[model samples]
Target: MKYLYYSLALFILSSFITPNDDADYEKEIKEWHKNRIESLKKENGWLNLAGLFWLEEGRNSFGADIENKIIFPTGKSGNFLGEFILSNGEVFIEAKKGAEIYHENEKVEKLKIFPSEKPILLKHHTLRWFVIKRGNKYAIRLRDLDSPFLKEFHGIETFQIDKKWKLKAKFEPTVGKKIAILDVTGQTSQQDSPGKLIFTVAGKEYALDALAEGDELFIIFGDITNKKETYGAGRFVYAAKPDADGFTSLDFNKAYNPPCAFTPYATCPLPPKQNLLPIAISAGEKNYGNH
Candidate 1:
């Protein structure tokens, strides 16, 4: 009897000492999330994104002119600072003599209005904007050099850290490129997709097809947690480029809400059909209150 009691005690002690992989993964995810929150709150982060103005075809005059030019916001001021000509996949903004352009909050005097390099900056007072190319379209992304949103910005909310949602997914390439249709606002467009991610949880297997966006594989997925614990429409997750063996980490703990969650001006992308999951993924960011 004495020997049996000692054996039982030893078994309990060993169980307590055993490493819990789930716990470790959750800790790592929490740290990554904390760092992300801090980065977004930094100067010049997405929290400062003020406006995304789409340029029309031909020359669109911008500045203080109400009739001829699109008027600048209150903090930004200038006269008929010339026009932003959008044509043939290129944008050229001709600035007047006294007009100043800024990157972030600092003046960029060396940046010419129509540089051969393209995507130059224009600034006045605490207002700064940059010309960028999205496919064949040209648009100006405006940011207030001293926007109040940045000044009063707070961190985003997240679900209680849980390790159960950190999943190891298997990548399965499609026979060829697949077409994915995206519905945003009232518009719908088709996008080319490489493949889908297959993973299992609670004895059930699931798959989510992803679209390429810049360097990351963008995935929009919905689950049972939607509208209750998660965002109603869906959420987004970006996986890094796969390794040589075509393997990548799909950590749902890093899932994040779209920009529309914070600001009404944002036109966010909705989740695709194949990406929706039937399981509850109880992890990642929660609903941001700003909306």
Candidate 2:
């Protein structure tokens, strides 16, 4: 009789105890979203992008003047700030006499812009520019540190944090597969694919092709939410590489808009046809602004 009483007492005590696991999970998601916002507000983020001008094979004049081959925002620079010379596939930038162009905080009258491990950044006042090569094309990507987009950015909208969107996935390896990825610029490139991530939602199973990105798997996906609440092109998410057992997790709560959703100047990759799901995935970030 004493043993029976002790068991009853323990059961009552256990019923009063509440697990904080859900609360802790919600906090973690909020912290991750905060870091995402911080990254987008940084100098190298997509918010500052102002222009993307394709460079011609010869001299391309750049300034505030309408007649210049590459026109900058009026009143931001002199009427004739500089010229970009493209010769035999090499690019060089020469600053106009009164234009004070600085690279790494050092004044530069002329400098080579291409043939380097990283894009060379040149700054003038609040404007920053660098050369970007995409496929066989080269272009000048310009950024304004004081861009209205950056200043007006509030925060991204996200779905209610729910643990149901966190799912267990199986990684099925297809090691030598290459997927065709189409960019916003109408260029299609082949990217290396490591495998497919198969997961189930609402008792239905779906698979997404996984792209190899360093130690993580990069996923560009679209769903029924795209037509309404999310970016039309798709959302991007990163999943941890599968372990020896070929298992991983797909946390849709971490999905986010591509750079193209934030800026027109960005050439973001679209989701492959096979990755588009017919089901509603009401998680992650929603579309920002009218874009």
Candidate 3:
């Protein structure tokens, strides 16, 4: 009995000295999350996004005038003299005499300004906007539009900061390239995804196919936490490039809400059909405000 008790004590001592893998992983996840929140709150981050305007197919006049086809802010009063024509997937703005049009900090002649096949950069006060292409369509993205970082903007809320939600995911290649359809308010487009992320929990395995967004793999998932710990419809996650062994890190601590979570001006994409997870992901940002 004495020997058995000594062995039991030794086992407990060794367990404490070595520590548990889960505890170490949780620490890393928390640190990553802290860094991520700080980055998003930076001046140029997505939190600063404020508007999205869709251009009409033809000439659209913009000014402070209530009767103008497209209206500008009150600060831009009396500056608009002509209209911008959208024809053949291009925008042409004819500026009036003494009017200024700047692209990338340089003033250019505006008589027959054929701006890039992209959105023109415009600034008034601290606000900035640029034209962006979404599936052959053009729209303007505004930053610092009516920015009241304290009044209009509220910080992100999170779950109880549990570690079980931090998961290890595995990559599973598809037989061939899979095209995933994204349905959003302003755009519906198909994106090609290389494969799916498979992970196991509670003795069960689940998979979520990843869609490419610029250099990152974007994922939208719905879980039991929906409407309880996270947004009702779903939440988003961005994964970096896989490592040399085809392994990727999926830190749920970095999960965030779609742009729609903050404002009505955004047209965020919904999760594709196969990307939904069957388990509850009780990590990351929670629902914001009433919406």
Candidate 4:
């Protein structure tokens, strides 16, 4: 993994210093894009997301039938698979007599789905449903591995991968700072922000707040190309945590679309107001289709 990161770093550095052979540079980028597509096609990928049903404060009937409070994709599950009971912020699943649902790889007739340590994934055939908490609302995220979108997917269109867009940045720590993150659902939440990243492009300096995502720094940034060449909501980029010298890498060439770009079911975070840049970033993935 470190080798791959450094390889791309070298490829990106080539634009500034000595350039590598054209074939080797393109090979790394081609492999990177190939892995991106493979990830989107995986069982847990965004393409298989079929439904995202918000669980109300009551028994929410869910099945393949249209009348259920939560409906699975037509052929993914049985007509009357089960019902999710959400009471006082807790979620429990009660499957029908012969309906199949498994938690922790064991068949379950009735099981507590939420308020646990790890995420409990309930699987039935090629369908999988998991409980997720977003603010005060609880939702069941349903995925079908055999989704048509996964089968019909070709590849996302991208701009010519250029090395110049990969930039080295300086992380400036912010004391007692939090950022307001607004999701596509119009719900705003506050998250801890380490600081802003400052980088220079074409002798112009720009700063953007960096939100810690586990060990990575997640960035939701919008540029002038939005609504014309990229997803209207914006694109997402990630970087490794800062080193001892407060230095991190930002590769705009890897900035890609959010989950909402591919599916309406995703509650993706929109770029913050301050993160919108006036400049046009012509690297990375382009708008695929009107979503």
Candidate 5:
């Protein structure tokens, strides 16, 4: 009688347990998209990218003048704004007097740009620039806080969220494998691939090369939806690390556009040949305006 009474009490409590799964899932995705927009609007976001000027081995003069080795946009800076001296893989800057260039808020006349150390950020009016090293090459990456792209950005378009797009996946480990990633700048780099994530969609099996990124797996992928609905170069997504049994999920709803979609200055890597899916993936973000 005591066991019967306890069983009756447990069954009565279980009857009250209800979950609004669809509403909860939709709200979760809505919140995720909102955070994505906020990130792109931040000060360090891609929307502010204004220019990418490669530095030569010798003195690279920069200004608004057409003759400059690195030209700033017209009316943005002085005709003889500054000179970046690249010698033996180290970069230094000589700011022209009265050009009003400031480094870390202090007016700079001459300073080692510190490419080996943390890059020294310099400012001219609304423009902020710093040195960046890519393999054996170095360049000045400029950003404008008042960029027109940032001002005009409302938000990105995305397909409606659906639970069916969240797919169960199996991770296949590939020891000592490297994937060649080509960038928009025509540079090809070999990135380390820890493994591949195999999943099924619409009763068809597919696989994507997974690169290690912190605690997540970064994936650059392409599909039939490209050129028509997505960025022509490709898209990027992240999946959590597989559990002990090598199981995870690929949430297509979280797939997003690469930095190149927002600015031409970004050197985003193209999706590898193997990652190009043969079917249309009608989820995640769409192409940005006239990208």
Candidate 6:
């Protein structure tokens, strides 16, 4: 929602693609935190995630009972809710007899979810589900409107909002550099590395490897606080891409926890080895509940 224009000319994009000047740290951080909380309360946020059942290659039965192949929380749906047929990387859902289910606001006896021709939103009462693809495997991510976490939700704990933590950094592109990243699920993946960010903190030189994420540069880094004060897995930060002169601002105040910090169901990438900094970054969101 802000932009820091460099001497080089390039159209400033949205906050998802841009950074801003340091003159308005209080206002920007306030807006950022408010939006973060709103996003978490949205229908698709991690707070509502109740179940993540991996589908085996075959007919996977689902219901509120534990005996089903995909067991949802009890009382959330009928005992024999439905069946998901996973075959050849495709999944088709067959509702149980007399089941009251709706897809895109229409009654359905069956529906092909994976390779979905259209956006498939399956809902039964307050339960919502969709297919999630991780690597070559498929899993059903279930959201419950009545999740206890969402009900008990307050707000995230954060380090003090300080303007000093926000600093400008030099973005130097490494061209074809990339790094291996591992998620909380132990699945390894790789992302494009546009460059390294060079910045100074407390008179010491520091650098971070950055991943190109759409229009913004994504940073997953760890600090000394990670061992005690911060999330053990690390934290995530985003910055606008470098302009022609190769410069962008790194606002540590905006650094936040990964999805895995909130839920075990999430697959959040761990910070690469090179991004780990020796000094402590005492800004941004702190540890939440025990995940």
Top candidate, metric TM-score: 2
lDDT string for model 1 (3-106, tens) is 99999998987777544655676678878887877776654456666676678888887776676446666446776666777766656666666666555565
Q: 195-285 in candidate 6: lDDT tens per residue?
A: 9999999998999999988899999999999958889989999999987888899999999988877777787889888888999999999
Per-candidate TM-scores read: 0.79, 0.93, 0.79, 0.90, 0.91, 0.89
Better of 3 and 6 by lDDT: 6
**Pairs with steric clashes in candidate 1:** 100-123, 101-122, 101-123
Least well predicted 10-residue stretch by lDDT in candidate 3:
108-117
Query: Against the true structure, candidate 1 has what lDDT?
Result: 0.70
In model 4, state the lDDT of residue 48: 88
Candidate 3 Cα misplacement greater than 4 A, ranges: 1-31, 41-43, 75-82, 96-101, 108-120, 149-151, 213-216, 240-246
Sort all candidates by lDDT, best to worst: 2, 5, 4, 6, 1, 3
lDDT of 3 by residue, 231-268 (tens): 77688898875677777877687788876776565667
Error of 3 at 121 (Å): 2.3
Better of 2 and 4 by lDDT: 2
Model 2 lowest lDDT segment of ten = 13-22
For each candidate, the alpha-carbon lDDT, in order, equals 0.70, 0.92, 0.68, 0.88, 0.89, 0.86
Error of 1 at 132 (Å): 3.6
Angstrom error at residue 23, model 2: 1.2
Angstrom error of the Cα, residue 266, model 1: value is: 3.8
Q: Candidate 5: where is the Cα deviation over 4 Å? A: 1-19
Best candidate (score: lDDT): 2
- Compose the digit string of candidate 4's lDDT tens values, residues 214-233: 99999999999999999998
Model 6 error, position 95 (Å) = 0.9
Find the 10 residues in a row with the least total lDDT in model 1: 107-116
- Rate residue 78 of model 3 by lDDT: 48
Task: State in Å the error of residue 177, model 1.
Answer: 1.6
